[model samples]
Target: MEKTYLTTDELAKKIKYDCRTIRERLKDSVLIEGVHYFRPFGGRKILYIWEVIEQDMRVSGHGFGIPMANGEVCHG
Candidate 1:
């Protein structure tokens, strides 16, 4: 399967967040490293997986459902 890689800016646009916010706030805090993003060829360039991020966003709730090690799943 061909992988879709998105830069911070592209990801920010897709998620409707600012690039700076994605880097400073979401990068290591919520988005995580290997799971949500990756450094290609050990370089500083980071690529985010859109499908994973979208899936996470759909599932993440303010207060709800099953509590996983990473986050909560929405019940309704």
Candidate 2:
């Protein structure tokens, strides 16, 4: 199946976030490398998997807090 890939600009527009914010804050923190995005041909350009991102966002939290890399959820 052909998946929907979106550029940083395109994704920012769809998600209503600034491209800079996505690149800096959300990139490695929430939007993972292989899971949410990938660089074609091992290049510097990134393309976000719209379907995966959308799906994850729909069920991201449980009224808890930030997800940690160590498999812990911090409630605030």
Candidate 3:
């Protein structure tokens, strides 16, 4: 399957979030590295996998809890 890769700005536009929030808040929190996004060619630039992110977004619940490393929420 072909995955759609999107830049931070592009993802912000599609997800209706400010680019800064995605960078500082979601980048390593809700949006994980290597799963949701990755730096291509070991470069600093990050590309997000749309399919993976979209799927997770659909199932992520709303609550106050810690976000697990594997993208699952740990309600404590």
lDDT of 1 by residue, 1-76 (tens): 5568899989878767788867765677678889989999999999998777777777865422333345433356
Candidate 2's error at 65, in angstroms? 8.8
Regions more than 4 Å wrong, model 1:
62-76
TM-scores of all predicted structures: 0.75, 0.78, 0.79
> What TM-score quantifies how close candidate 1 is to the native fold?
0.75
Global lDDT of each model?
Answer: 0.74, 0.81, 0.81
> Model 1: how far is 66 from its true place, Å?
21
Better of 2 and 3 by TM-score: 3
Query: Residues 1-76, candidate 2, lDDT per residue (tens digit)?
Result: 5799999999989988788867766788778999999999999999999988888877855332454557555655
Candidate 3's C-alpha runs over 4 A off are 61-76
Candidate 3 matches the true fold with a TM-score of 0.79
